[model samples]
Target chain A: MPPTSIKSRFGSRIRSLRDDRGFSQEELAERAGLHRNYVGGVERGERNIALENIVKLAKALSIPTRDLFTDFP
Target chain B: MPPTSIKSRFGSRIRSLRDDRGFSQEELAERAGLHRNYVGGVERGERNIALENIVKLAKALSIPTRDLFTDFP
Candidate 1:
């Protein structure tokens, strides 16, 4: 298994889920009212987003935040 | 509240619980068959230790792993 950071795991999970829904980073960011760069950083596991931002992302993406990371492989 | 990474929360909780038990970082690492530096790294939120290692730490500390991070403030 790849050595994964806590944020990276969450980010990877988010990317996987967003990809699963066929949503682009730009689209998801727009929906979440976050910057595209910020979304990309989040997806790449390069940022430590706030829990509030997480809630916003979850709400915009229509997925529970836990669901984004709980089942990561 | 300050933004936290997942592992930091876990590590802080571990430190708290270990302190609760009057155990030093070296003591806990020895109990868990982990290096003292590794334990320090985990405590400082600077490393992404494996799930297996987490399990070992939990077992050695005699606390459920979820208790380390769940209900974090």
Candidate 2:
């Protein structure tokens, strides 16, 4: 199998974190002030994900931006 | 004082890491397969910075992408 892309890994990371927080995609999107579809895209690894959006997600998740990348390969 | 933007903090982090690695902006850009001007813009906090480019820079720096956010506020 091809190695997982970092985007996929990052997306999985976000999904896992959202799960840990018991957040629905809509809730997370609301908290991040992003469109629900945009949040969905990021979680699905379909977005390139700019730093600003990353920061918004981190803020919404109540974690340091660095923590968003914890255990990353 | 106004709070520093995360973009600026991230940019400074990259610059500091580049300095620690003893790399000129051009050399680092070359390693990351990015344009020197683009790298310069990133370091200047003038770019929003996509995840793929972030990964490229992390690989070029021989660091985990998480390490790029070390000591982030």
Candidate 3:
């Protein structure tokens, strides 16, 4: 599989989680201490997200880091 | 929590996994297509690893991406 697919998969997962938690991109960005544009790009699979940022997102969403990775093949 | 702590926690988890899988840093680096020095840095908790690289490492380890994060609290 190509790297782009991996990123897109991750982005899709993040979006699903955000939606489940009733958070908009801007809300998630604020909670994660990331820029809204950056969060949007991540959800769009356009950014290669960093670990720290992932951790922030997980914490903001009150979920485990692994939860973001669930259902990924 | 500080970002450095998060990085270190992730590094510790990687090292534990590598040990469990009987992989040297060089071997893991080769498997992940990352630089050996970079893998070493990550193991030492000194690298803010990107998601793409994290996916590479997980794939190389023959494990789910979530497994790398299992013990992190």
Q: Give me the displacement of residue B1 in model 2, in angstroms.
A: 1.7
If both were scored by DockQ, which would come out higher, candidate 2 or candidate 3? Answer: 2
Best by TM-score: 2
- Tens-digit lDDT string for candidate 3 (A1-73): 5554877888898898899999999999999999999999999989889998988989988999998898664
TM-score of each: 0.49, 0.96, 0.91
What are the per-residue Cα lDDT tens digits for candidate 1 across A1-73?
8788756876887788789889999999999999999989987878777545765687778965444445433
lDDT by residue for model 3 (B15-62), tens? 988999999999999999999999999988899999989999999888
Candidate 3, Cα interface RMSD: 1.1
- Model 3 misplaced regions, further than 4 Å: A1-4, B1-4
Q: How close is chain A of candidate 1 to the true chain A, as a TM-score?
A: 0.86
Span of 10 residues, lowest total lDDT, candidate 1 chain B: B64-73
Give lDDT per model, in order.
0.74, 0.91, 0.89
Q: What's the candidate order when arranged by decreasing DockQ?
A: 2, 3, 1
For residues B1-73, could you state the per-residue lDDT of candidate 1 as single tens digits?
8888756766787788889999999999999999999999888877666545765777788865444445443
DockQ of each: 0.07, 0.78, 0.76
Best by DockQ: 2
Q: Candidate 2 at A17: error in angstroms?
A: 0.6
Docking class of 1: incorrect
